[model samples]
Structure formats: C-alpha cells, structure tokens
Target: MSQSASQVYGAVQALTQSSDTLFLLLGAIMVFLMHSGFAFLELGTVRKKNQVNALVKILADFGVSAVAYFFIGYQIAYGNNFFVGAETLAQGNGYELVKFFFLLTFAAAIPAIVSGGIAERARFYPILIATFFTVGFVYPLFEGMIWNNNYGVQTWLETHFGYGFHDFAGSVVVHGVGGWIALVAVKYLGMRKGRVRAGKHTNFAPSNIPFLALGAWILCVGWFGFNVMSAQAINGISGLVAINSLMAMVGGILVSLFAGKNDPGFIHNGPLAGLVAICAGSDIMHPIGALITGGIAGAIFVYLFTYLQNKTKIDDVLGVWPLHGVCGAWGGIAAGIFGQTSLGGLGGVSLVVQVGGTVLGIVIAVLGSIVVYGVIEKCSGLRLSEEDEFNGADLSIHKISAINED
Candidate 1:
C-alpha cells in the first residue's frame, strides 16, 4: 500500500478534507451557541413578563431559519442544493453539508437580530413567517451579490472602483441587513404601548443585568469562530482576524464605558457594537485600525441608542438598529478606510464601493422587510392583542413564566 503514489495522494487529500470539515463543524457549533446568547440577551432586556417569549422566539426562529436556509436560502445565496442521493451528498466528508450548517447559523442570526427589536408586542407565528421570508428569500440575494459575486456585482465594482467590496465576515451582509430589517419591523409595529405618554418618553430598564452580561459574554466568545472560521478552510485561517477581532471588541468596550458614562446596559452592549463593525474588515484590518473602527461603533451604539429612545418615538427594544444596523454600516465603510496600506492594512479596498455596497444592503433590507412584514401584518397581524400585550408575551403566548410557582 505504501508503494503507490496515487494512494498516498488520495490519503492526504482525504485527511485534509476531514480536518477542514472538523474545523468548520467546530465553528458552526460555536456560532450555534451564539443563539443562546441572543436568547439570553433579549430575555434580560425585555420586561420580566416577556422573558419566556424571548427564549421561545430564539429557539423557534432557529428551527424555522434552519429549514428555510437549507431548502431555499443556501441555494439562493451560493446556488447549491441538496437534491441528491445520500451517497452523493456524503462525498468529501460531507463538507458541503457542514458548510450549510455553518452558514445557516449566520442566516439564522439575521432573524435573531430582528427578534430583539420586535420583542414584547409581536405575535409569535407571524414573526416566524417573517423569519422564513427573510432567511429564505431577502437576505440571500444580497449575500449572493457580495459573497458569491452573483449578478456580476463584484466584477462591476472592480471594473469601476478598482476593487470589489470586501466584507470579511458580513458586517454589511449579515448585521446591516438584519439591523435595517429590524428597523422596518419596528416602524411597522410602532412603539410598545405607552412608551411615550404626553410627549415624554418612558424608559423600561433591562430586566436582569446578569443575564444580559452573560449573553454578551457568550456572543463575544462565539464571535472568534464567526470571524476566523469565515475562511472556511483551516489552511486559510489567519491570526490577524483573531487579533483584530479582539482589539475591536475592547475598543468598543472602552469607548462605550466613557460615552455611556458607566451605564450597565451600554457597557454590556459595547463589545457587540465593535464586534459587529469589525466583522467586515477583520481579515484585512490592522489591530489599531480595528480598535478605532470598533471604538467608533461603540460610540455609535451609545449615542444613537440614546437618541432614538429619547429624541424620537422609535421604540427599538434593545437598540438593534444602532447596534447592528448603524454599526454594521460603519464597519463596512471603516473597512474601506482602514484596509488601506497607509493605515497598516492589507489594502485593495475602495471606500466608495464600500459605501455603495453597504447602501445596497440597507436598501434591500428596508424594502424587503416592508413588503414581507407589511404582508404579514395584513394577513395574520404582527402584534399581540392589546390584552396580550398588557398581560405580556410570556403569559399570553407561552402560558407560563420564566419562573414557575409550583
């Protein structure tokens, strides 16, 4: 057996594929754990009565998202499908299937982000329908455009702007799309009942700080997988992405600590803002550039979150719009700036193309969300019945509380 060159080559190839499959599987599991982060984060932010609903929505939406992306979204984004026999599907250690698993987590995250904004008052099933439409249809189009270069978008960008838009881990594709879609859903749902009375806003503080912090920590840890594993192959993994992600996360924390004046909520969310922003550029950005990008994202979250709550009637429950939407957009643009060679990055980025691509994702998200959410509202209704809202999502929807009195 050792005498055959062909046998040795095949053995080596098989080993490489197996190793890569294992790497991506681990990454998928880590990102999968972030769903729990989403659940706990929403649970701690909403009123206590809505805690059960928060947990339920994350789990339920994940199920729906998995089905949607597997059957529909993956094909739409990457133009691949699972319409083959089991033997054919299992080829190459089932790497394609595992890829589907990893990317499904990202697709599912869009709905999770939206879940945060529309929590408390939304009807459960309609929200599921929204997730189906988004993960299955809307998000995939833009994902294909930038990531897969569908529609010649990257080619066109290169022809005109000298570089294709770069989003290493989907600052614009995932977070931007999710955040803007949440904005539309929030707009359609309107403020939680009596969020503002007599032109004065009423603030509802987070229900449990410990849970919120725990959620933040989980997401922070899981994000390393999110960024590093984007390479999809172990050989492609880079220490730069890891270090950049770290710098950005702390950058966000330090900036939010100062800008938010030590507010617990802002402090907890600060790292998320940075992480979200750095996702686009983590591969190419220097650590210092990542820190600035992340720090700015933190400031954006704190400032815009406060402004939206106080200066406007937009009742985004967890400030998803600022944390994801605005910060994600900032990350997209920041990548263009910081990815320049002069800035200690790998370069080959164009700022104008970055803005254009980011805007494209936003426009698609906003329009798609409006139609999808609007149709859902017209048919099944989007919000809970007033009685249900007053009683809270837990008792009204789930028929129990997070804590039970036996």
Candidate 2:
C-alpha cells in the first residue's frame, strides 16, 4: 500500500477507537447517576427521620467501592489494575479506566441494594466496611467467572450444554447477587424496630412519593446506557438491546399497575423490576419476548413482596428480593428460553446452563453475605440500639433528620 493510503487507514482507526471510548465513558456516567437514584429511592421510602442516613450511606458506599475496585476488585475480575503510572495507564485510549468506572458502579450497587433492605437500623460504618469487603472481594469473584470467563466455568457450561450461560448484561451477576445478599443482611439485622409485632407487619408509608418517583425515573432513563452500553464498542452497539429494554419497561409498568392495585409506589418500581429482568436477555430476546419477561417480573415483585413482608415478616424495606433477586434470576433463565430461535430470539443459549449459572450466583451471594455480615455483626454489631432505633438513623448516626422545626 502507498504511504498516503496507510495514513488514511490510521486516521480511520483512531476515529473508531475514540468513538468507542466516548460511548463507554457515557455509559459509566449514566450508571454512576443510578447511585443517586438508589439514595433518593431509599430517602423517599424510609421514615423521614431516617432519610439523611439513606443518602449518606449510598454516597459513602460508592466512595468505598471506588477505592476497593481501583485497588483490588477490578484486578480480581479482569486481571487488570491501575497500579502503574497515569501515563502508562492512558495508553489504551484510556478504555480500561472507563471500563473500571462502569463496573465499579455495578460493584457499588450491591451495598446500595442492601441499604434498602437493612435501612432505618443498620450502623453506618459497619455497612461501609461491608461495602469495602463486598466490592473488594465477594462481587468480583463471580464477576470473573461469568464476564471474564475465569476458572473455565463458562467453558465447562458450553461444553456440557452446547452453550454457556448467556447473561448479555448482568441480571444474575449484579441484581441477583445484590438482592440475595440484601436478603441475608436483612435477616441477620432483624426487622426494623416496630416493623413487626405478633406476626403482623406494620405499614410505613413512603415519606415523599415525588422523590421516589424521581428516583425511579432516573434509574429508568439511565438503564438504556446500562444495557446498551454493555456492548462496549461503537460497532457492537445494537438497536435491538435498546428496543428490548423499552418494551420490557412498558410491560413492567402496565403489569405492575394492574397487579399492585394502582399503588403509586408499585407503579414506579414496576419499570425497575422489568429492567432488572430484561438485563440478561436484552441482547438476544425479541422485543415481544422482553415484554413477557418483564410482565412476569412485575407481577412477581408485587405478589412476593406482599407475602415476604406480611406472611413471612422479612421486612425487606424496598422489596429488593422480589424486584432484584427473584426477577434477576428469572431473567437469567428467561434468556435461555426467550433467546432460542424457536422463541424468535438469537438462539445461542441453553436452559440448563442458564439455570445452573443463576443458581450458582445466588449461592455465592448468599454465602458471601452471610460470612461478611456475620463477622461484622459479631465484631462491631450491625443494628442500632432500641433507643437509637426510636430516635431514627438520621438523628442517631448523622445527627440530623430530613425535616426539622425549631
């Protein structure tokens, strides 16, 4: 080739790489904003007296997760770390740095999910410690197994079942793990004070519905980046992922509106439930299949949340188990079913592998949370004193409440 032709090719390659980097950077920012959604969602759900703690915990947990992932978790998951000089780190178009930012947002979400379940009573620093450990160690372990194909789990699955587990994004990996971990933490921390009495659950109405709705809206809008950007390259981006996400969102909304009896809280959370379920299959499932998957998730959340809170007295404040744990697991399995050619999907998934991978993820999450939270519980204690609980987490921990009158 002539020198002029070579120079032209170099320019085109540089432009493509730059565009991909920009695409992923935007994705990281969008997922980062979801942390605020987590905060405000808890802020609106918890009693006003505990609202400040909700905000503080989400922000603090993100800071801790960033530190942990930068130092250790990213390496565990992807065999890469920012240990070298900044000059060297910037060599790969800084794509690795942006990728870390994106996955770090996901790692931070574990504590954010647990925050809701253990809200109104958990000690702040202990939960932060849990955040550090979870992001640093627990989450990255399985993240490596699936996303990075570490330890040959995916390879083994593919060999045995003719396809590996197919979580295009992270339905089982992120939301499912976070939700199950939250369940264990909630159980260990015990119910919030006055939440249960004589086998009955008390109703604590959301303090600010508008804040709750705003948070849900933020998460809903940001989910496009979360799903679409998982493609991670300009050339790999897909209109199908975006459309599947939209269909699932509307399906969740419509179903939850019906299933939840028009409750505003449920209606807002419906889209989130759908998004969580569709994350695993967004790349492979048809839009109509995505709708069905999301509709089931919406109905599952409403019914199970009621049963867990009332009959089982689980006291999961935000219903993370139903919205994330179960629905996320369902999403993983649904990918195997709905991603089949027979189901009008892309057809490179297996039901057995999907079920196996989903269950493995939940098992790892449960064991990790139990060990981490159990140690924290025994050592520094996890819950507030009864007196402090009555005073509320905002006043007791942060020395302030959401509203005050002199």
lDDT of 1 at 387: 94
Worst 10 residues of 1 by lDDT: 1-10
Q: Tell me, by lDDT, which candidate is best.
A: 1
- Kindly give the number of clashing pairs for every candidate: 0, 0
| lDDT per residue as tens, model 1, 1-406 | 4669888999999999999999999999999999999999999999999999999999999999999998999999999999999999999999999999999999999999999999899999999999999999999999999999999999999999899999999899999999999999999899899788898999898999999999999999999999999999999999999999999999999999999999999999999999999999999999999999999999999999999999887889999999999999999999999999999999989999999999999999999999999999999889998999999999999899988879
The residue-level lDDT of candidate 2 at 20 comes to: 82
The C-alpha RMSD of each candidate to the native structure, in angstroms, is 1.2, 0.9
- The Cα local distance difference test for each model comes to 0.95, 0.91
Q: Candidate 2 lDDT (Cα, whole model)? A: 0.91
**Cα lDDT of model 2 by residue, 1-406, tens digit:** 9999999999998888788889999999999998899988989888889999999999999999999988999999999977799998886688878888888888888888888889988988998999899889999999999999999998998888889888888999999999999999989888877777776677789999999998899999989989999999989999999999999999999999999999999999999999999999999999999999999999999999988878775889999989999999999999988999999999998898899999999999999989999999999999999999999998899898777787
